[model samples]
Target chain A: MTSPSVPAAPTLTPALGRKLHPWPVRIMHWTNAMAMIVLIGSGWGIYDDSVIFHFIYFPQWARIGSWAAESLLWHFAAMWVLAINGFVYLTYGVFTGRLRERMLPIRISDVIHTVQDTLRFKIAHEDLTVYNAVQKLLYIVVIFAGISQVITGIAVWKPIQFSGLAEVLGGFQGARLLHFLGMAVITGFLIVHVALSLLVPSTLWAMLAGGPRLKTPKLEAAE
Target chain B: MRSPNRPATPPDAAILDNHRAEIRMLERRGILRGTLSLGSLAMLTGCDISDDTSIGKALRAMSSFNDFVQAKIFDPNHLAPEYPASMVLKPPRFNAYYEIEKIRPIDGPNWTLAVSGLVNDKQAWTREKIATLPQREMIIRHICVEGWDYIGQWSGVPLRTFLEAVGADLNAKYVSFQTADDYPSSIDMATALHPQTLLATKYAGETLADPFGYPLRLRTSTKLGFKNPKWITAIEVSNTYMPGYWEKLGFNWQSGI
Candidate 1:
């Protein structure tokens, strides 16, 4: 056999010729993130103000008084922004098939590979793809959660106008409970996502700057 | 487990190519969903944008601001249009809670208006005392925030007339209404004393039903259905205002009809 081919040297460089994120995707991503943060924060305010949960005793210093009406107004207004933005983004994703490519797993293998890569920390910084497996799963989950919130919100908004939907959800009380639960889930996920971002600084930078510097590994030259 | 600190291998050209292909597909799907949803939201926006739609404007204006966002959709100054006597309907199903379990007569002798707290005088008066006062009648539509509406004729003394006699104390901020059924609610004294508000004793020209505040009820035409507390009982005047039953349970307190 001919002498073994020499291995190419590893290099550290800015991701050259790599496509930057599309404007719509970038804009929507940041907007959704910011809106969700505001919504979850204001939602906590509302929960604190709720009379039903006011039975719990807290020190005067630790306790926050209920401002139900004010909290409701905050929630309602922010809801329109969050809802409209999500509707636009989701619609765009579906029609453009971007949702299927970026947000949805292409196949079982891709999903499996993603999971394995995440578990093994085998994801490459230089990967041209925008999201890794964990990110993809989270994006999908958030979209579904947003849809659930809209459905449950309407059920509570006009119980009579959407009587059938309300009935399906077991009336106003049930709808209210579901809406509360949805908020809690979203809030929980947000906390986890922030934590992960801190753990993976590069991933956070990718979202912020639309790309990151990646170090390519050395490879053996073919004989 | 592989250490994340270790550099990850770059995905091969084939994988990148596959991702590019998938991204293209997703892009197309995303565009379709975006257009469809945008169109739907546009339609929704259009419905609420017209300036002449009082309720829609109120909802939208209030949506953006911290204020109550009242457009004065219903004018309290104007008397609620009277309905023909024949248009009045009786309770097909009596809607009383406490009296449903037990029948109780609310007569002039048994009924007393407890005018106290934040008032110049704290005293109880017989229903006869109320009946002897100047009476006014109006046919008004009771609109529930839940969206049902019904027209009923009310005959009673005006709450403002009573407040005038008692001389409301300067510190009085709200009037808390407690009915015989134990159903309770509160309203700003200003709202309680509004011209359309009546301490009603008659409906459809007949004596009140036990289920319908037999001797008297606080009938405020300017408010949603629940604000018009039924049944005659104690009235406490207070210096601070708070939410009522449904209001505490997520319903609007002012609950303008």
Candidate 2:
């Protein structure tokens, strides 16, 4: 009962110091978030220059670069930061095994249960250190989306140079649409993540400073 | 489905307020993040940081870095995709910085391609003299920075051959074009020498349309559409950077495809 993180994560709890995000994790998370914001806003600006869809339009307010050229500059500049930071995060997460420990072994049953409970306004977030199946799925999906954005972005940006990648994405126009889709998914994730953090303020506090040092979760072993 | 360790309560207003206060009291790191995110939010509502002098400078610097990278990555021998002659568009889309009415059609009979700058032979070229040079044709995608694309067939002397014939300094950093329409543009030396680079005289086997550079235009498959200035007036082989018409207006100078 002393190992109190999830359905069971005995091997990870103490090693991870689950109450606090590691310094590298915290640093990379904030930096990645900032760069993502810049990328999304600038991307909107560039898309507006010659929109792929006639019906879809983003107002000037929703854009970063005032002009198409300036938007491209901002987009490229932020891309390097996002890419380098993402690479570091991936290396750290994989090498340290944090990605596996925190977000692996998702069961479909658990996901269904979580969804049913969420619809009924029942959340099992008593432990900030543990992620439900839904949470794990979301984190993994967002990471994949981020990687896909980079790939598709390169395809459109240099369709001739990266012809194979463009072909993979169904050519130049296809690459642009896929990149936009990635942005939409990430935006959706951002909304849900922020909302959840508000619902569980302690989790936000924990992210900022390690949570209350629980000597034990009233050990289930005590009967 | 509450766990045995559950708090048995939802977060209250007091908790939210306390965390808000704590966030406000955090050190410079938190404040900096707050300001940045706030600025991002402000940007979403029409804040124009692009107009800021410092930010403009930073964006310009980034564009220059992109140019540097594009130059480094450009493989001289890598040809842009060539289309079949059948794929070439008839009456290709005409595009220029100005309206159709503003097209300054070159007076072909009076036209002479004045060559200057770093060149061994400064002799100007006439349409009749250029006609005598070996002619080659290519069908390549004309990709515009505004996101449209067209495939067109252009016939002309390969720019490399013409440069050699004119004794232009091939080693020069740039070959700038001043067009009859006053739309000046320049390309990198590597692109200038690319096999697809042409001093185009005809489009789709017909002499150029008045609106599409009647006498001669510079066409390079390696660069964006705007870099291919129409209605050529002068050619300068130079070591110095010559500001292009669009580049002066914030478009990246090295607009390599």
Candidate 3:
């Protein structure tokens, strides 16, 4: 909510828009993007190195580095970057009240309605600042999925010392399976996320350059 | 029942069937599948997955928790599943840091296993004397960290028998092993005393081939292949943790599957 004394869009212009993402958010966003790419690519190679399911195998092209050892190095290195960057982003979000404002206040009804709206193709691209119920749900899920990947990653990486964590995940073999499954979930989310971004090009613009270009509609006057 | 004219299933096929049944058993026990879904994970770990630092810390802490749980649940008496002799892989895969051709042959006649550290018997064990110890044979799959696995028949004195004969301090925390090839490794005492843990002398019913760590090797199904050190030269039991070659390079010390 904007204060009464301050203008709504400080840098709004006919051709451009105000900054929606702060510098920290933008920096962390790109860093996270890079980390995810490295993680998924290297993760595939690691998965192929080990046999989990008897019948299923990752395609060769999906694998990252040439060798298992090399892929593992990339996976570990990217993991650290992802973890630290995620930590900073989360800390900033919580302390700045951004997480609460954006992702919270979700209701079961909102989720159900959003799913129905999505299925019927009736959803509107109304407000860039305000996340739709479906967007909120997905963002939350993806965040959690990232965390799960890290946890399962550690369990598989160091099963002996982390035997308890691995055991909770089922065991060494089970942890490997869960790790692969987590990767699959994240990959699925990435696909849907990219498609949605393409559908809403303004959202992509906001992510890359802070905010979307548009005229303030009557919704702001109502607020 | 099969007709007399029908051919019997190949030995390797039987082994594969046994492996499949074992996997099914694990699945049934909730060890391989269906137990660690996202919902269950959320419940088991109280922190929300979106809470990065808390979840990371919690998961790291859980590693130790896992170690504790595994240590408690480990059954020293429980044996790794064994296969029939016909299932043994021909020319069991040679795996080592060095190439097979570069492996320096240990002179079998003069070779002796040195015993040291927290043991009453400090005398070296000659191959002949080691052979006289009560022997055991097992056909177990050697799972490698690199992911391939092979079933092989290993014949040796039970490590427990050797430890007891050496008057080892059974309460020691760790058992360190040093190989003639300069590769060092260790295992927890509980694992050292496991019935399946072997001071292997032979492979495929004959004396261990040079490439397979002739004279002696450590063999156990509980651990990954790297944990089973070959060309073993010395044994030391101590309270302090001594990391192995791969373990020093970030591999888990307790590499049990």
What is the per-candidate TM-score for chain B? 0.66, 0.81, 0.74
| Chain B global fold similarity (TM-score) for predicted model 1 against the true chain B | 0.66
Q: TM-score of every model?
A: 0.46, 0.84, 0.56
Q: Give the per-residue Cα lDDT of candidate 2 at A152.
A: 88
True contacts kept of each: 0.07, 0.32, 0.10
Each model's interface RMSD (Å)? 12.8, 3.8, 11.7
For model 2, the local distance difference test gives 0.80
**Residue-level lDDT tens digits of model 2 in A1-223:** 3334444434434453344477687778888888888899889888887788899888987777666766777788889899999999999887766787668768999999999999999998886666899999999999999999989888767777666677789776788789989999998999999899899998777766756443332352242
Candidates' lDDT values, in order?
Answer: 0.61, 0.80, 0.76
Best by lDDT: 2
Candidate 3 pairs with clashing backbones:
A163-B66, A164-B66, A164-B67, A165-B66
DockQ for each model: 0.04, 0.19, 0.05
Q: Give one digit per residue, the lDDT tens place, for model 3 in B42-67.
A: 22222122224332334444433544
Query: Which candidate, 2 or 3, has the higher DockQ?
Result: 2
Give the per-residue Cα lDDT of candidate 2 at A109: 98
Candidate 1: clashing residue pairs, number: 31
Residues A1-223, candidate 3: write the lDDT tens digits: 6664555333222222335676688899989987897788778767776667767676756665444544554566578789899999998887766676568668889889989998999766767876778889989988998889889877776554455686799766777778888888889989999999899898888888887433352344355
> After superposing candidate 2, which stretches have Cα over 4 Å from the reference?
A1-14, A210-223, B1-52
